[model samples]
Target: MSKVYILMGVSGVGKTTLGMMLAEELSVPFYDADNFHSASNKEKMQNGIPLTDLDREGWLGKMSSLIPEWQSSNGGVLACSALKEKYRNQLAGGIDKDLEWIFLFEDFSIIADRISKRKLHFFNPDLLKSQYDTLEPPDYGIHIKVENSPEESLKEILQKLNMPEFGIIGLGVMGKSLALNMAGKNFLVSVYNRREGELEENIAQNFVDKYSDKYQLQGFDDLKNFVFSLKSPKKILLMIKAGDPIDEIIEELIPFLKTGDLILDGGNSHFKDTERRLEKLSELGIHFLGVGISGGEDGALNGPSIMPGGSKEGYNRVKDLLGSIAAKDRLERPCCNYIGPGSSGHYVKMVHNGIEYGEMQLIAEFYYFMRYFQDRSPEAISKVFTEWNLKQISFLLEITADILLKKENNQYLLDKVLDIAGQKGTGGWTTVAALEVGVSLDTITASVFARNISAFKKHKNQVRELYKLKNKADLEITDDELFKSYRSASVINHSIGFELLRIASVEYGWNLNFSEIARIWTNGCIIRSSFMEKLSGIYDSTKSSHLLLYPDIAEKLNEDQEIFTRIIPAILSQGCPMQVCSSALNYFLSFTRENTPANLIQAQRDYFGAHTYERIDKPRGEYFHSNWKPE
Candidate 1:
């Protein structure tokens, strides 16, 4: 243990006890900041007086000076009331990232109760209010709730400190890559891939043979050995398939895992399935985390946005490890956070995939206009995408450019590839969830429908032969107009997805931080872009769940609507489907308008079936029935 550990919190939050326990576990020296307090300061605190900042300056400086000495000597743990940001900075001596700050937070009444129970402590229990008032919790650092036992807290701290002590149950693309990533970060990584047959090559062992020389990696074919190899409070990440496979693996591992062991499902499991597994594991005293990892195989190897929900205690234990392997946002913060509890991670990931589908379809519509309607060659279309990528800056846009550029045998490979698109159910799940929650996801639903229609290639070919549909000639638009239209549609696409997230957050009591979600999606994920970066700021500044209602956003939409409205119909005139674009335009039109034809629909319903309709002349929520045949 060569690192310095600072347990920072208000008084009577078990900092000293945890610090001493951690120090003993690591065989290091433990220093209590109270031991260095001046006699007068202690006397004032004993008389129920709170010490001012000026009074604690010297004590903090003394503790700061001892940091280098302790670091030089093996290591050390210090329990200090580093409540304020300035106090922690002073103690860190500008080396903030080097020292691990474990913030022990609990309810105010709990701290007050513990302080009242103190027999001979110099600090006054009455000064607890002043202490809490002075406290400014840092956003950084490892946060550990003080509700758990000291032993449990110590276990979390030690597990976080011990790098590379992680196990991966599956050595598939993501599993192997992530294992290497963790090992590359100096984690002791244990990997196991189940061998289905006696003659089957050991995937885990093969992985070790290839990369173990460069990294601290071990492979196990035996399930029990892999589970036993990890340190206590075993942190195992399962990168297997979602649904039944996840449940099967859990049941197999249940016998080997202990009471406090942690399991992280790093797959796109359904939120409901994750919730059920969480409840089941809680009954067995096993912690389960639904971890949504995005950015494909490459992102998994390098970095990706990680969303983990369920068992906050389990999350805290592995936060350091995940943060080490996750991508960085513009400010260089790790793109990983505990996204509330009970399967919210999977829910967010599902919406992210839905957004991805919409974005991909929008980009495809742009390509279709350029290639088919404008009759541009692949090289020319690739150039167009290159320019668009400069302005739009998204993973899908960048990859679309690459796909257009790829050629084999003097022909574009994209042209030879099948027109049908395949989906893995996440996008459909998102649409179904929106329907269940009464949220409109028109653009995402259209994207999913676009894919579904693409799958009917044979039927479409027959229909094309019967109708002889031809793309209209001489249909052209300026690049600037096209870009504006695409940008408008993209904005609407995200608006619908986030609106669903907002409604679902309320329905499920997730209390999601929209800004944090945007921040994390700004990098690594499939939808990463400068646009997402702008969105993160918008979410923070507006502090509103409905993104379309943000003043600046609404103003921009108002400006862009003219072109967006004209271009979709123009593309449709040229025989391009542009379903997502059309859906986006309709969604925006329906949402922004003050009145709609739905009033007539309500009248028709009331006339036919005596169903109720709200009166426009009366207050809202007042219902009236009409009968057309009663005359």
Candidate 2:
């Protein structure tokens, strides 16, 4: 295990600085556990007051359990003021740190002087006396004599720890580059590979191969042998292809994995696969994560959108190691925040793809109209789509416009594309789930249908050949009528899709925050738009079971019936299924009716429950038994 160190002292005691330097001296990472403090603790600290022991207990517990896995592999130093026996006890139970503490202590006057000189930050200088007052000198091991210079104290502590460093798995382009990046961050890395060639490459890539001494490149020939090359708990980030290759490697490595061993699936794996892996590995007591590594290869080596989903316990283990390497959110919080259960991360990714499908379809439809029906050239269509990105649509759609503008293979490739789209399992899963939960996935289903129809070269051919009949209505349509009708129809269809999403979210117990989901998509996944933000907040102001009734959203759809009206006629003319969208629109419209299919069904329900039916124009509110009995 890596050297487990905690920079213990008050706010102004220079914990962050000493911890960074000490970890650097030991050639390991540093986790500022204080950064992991919850909102309330942070607020308490910001208020220039010391947190009561009761207030700090759970927070300390959380931070303490976090450092073990980092230490379990190549240990790193973490900064937390383990000022009390209880606080240290809580951390001791949770983190399983083997009673190792290089307590960084300083005089109250010195700490106050150090704090007053620093620029404004979260911690308060006014609380300096309170921290010293609350401090409990640890029943400790090696103590850094911080009575001297910071560097001297750090050097004394490192000498005691006798820190030994190692490299990382893989030494090819990605592995080699990652090694360099870590080393650039001043971390000594041990690069490993299945072949000797990879190690050679890593050595060369290291500028002048300066890290030849720290670089411990070894062949992954034997499981135990490879395991020995790394430190405790063996933090192996499997950066291989997602699916079977990962599965096969895990099977080979399972036997050698220790109880607290950690395996991070930092690949483009589906969430379900992550879920499956978590479940399987948990039985072996091996911790695993389906970490969604966004930013592609470059992002992976530098920084990426890392959506890690697994046990909170496992996350605690490696929390110290991740540090600033993780992506930050809008709150300046680590993007490495735990998603949900085993596959919750991948599940989010799936929904990401599903929404992506809907967004792309919407853009595609817009592109199609501009190119053919509107009689615009590819360049003109691209320009219009690009212009539309200026609106509040999410990053998903904005990036889509970028993708549209880029020339592919010397073609306005979008124009050359067939009317059909391709899909993986996500879009289908969304629709299937909608059906299972009795939710109408109008847009998503329609996208799938469109993709299916794209494979209709023969059907298209036959339809063209059999086009003896002419659509007299389409031929006679005016511009006003066309836009008005089509726009309204599109609205109806879109409403139906959203309604399904709402219903499914409710039924499945996702506590689905349409607003939050929309906010995230504003920069991620697909269908990220300002419209979605408006849509997300729609449910916030009202508890309407039906989204079609949302006044603001409804206005957008209904205000211009001219455009959507075309969708209905076109769908009807083309024999496409409009059940998801149209059925929803019709459901809303018919809500005003006193006698509905649902009411009739309710009558049928009473006919079975009590064999009773209600009268249409009854003066009294009473149920009546069916007079017509079975013969």
TM-score top scorer: 1
At residue 621, candidate 2 shows an lDDT of 77
Q: Which one is best on lDDT? A: 1
> lDDT per residue, candidate 1, 1-631, as tens digits?
2688899999999988998998998898999999999999999999998888899899999988989888877778899989998999888886533477788899999999999999978888999998888999875456788888999988877765554368998878888888877888888898988788865468888889999569888788998988767766678999998889999999999998877789999999999999999999999989999999998889898998999999998897789889999999978999999998899999999999999999999999888888888888878888877898898788888888899989899888887999999899999999999999999999999999999989887787689778966675466698888888999999999999889988998899988888899999998899999889888888863256688988878888888888889988988876778999999999988998899999899889988788899986999999998665655
Write down the TM-score of every candidate: 0.78, 0.58
State, as a TM-score between 0 and 1, how close model 2 is to the true structure. Answer: 0.58
Weakest ten-residue segment in model 2 by summed lDDT: 470-479
* RMSD of candidate 2 to true structure, Å: 12.3
Clash totals in order = 2, 31
* Candidate 2, superposed: residue stretches over 4 Å from native: 1-246, 264-276, 291-306, 316-336, 396-411, 415-420, 468-516, 524-527, 532-631
Q: Report lDDT (Cα) of residue 511, candidate 2.
A: 43
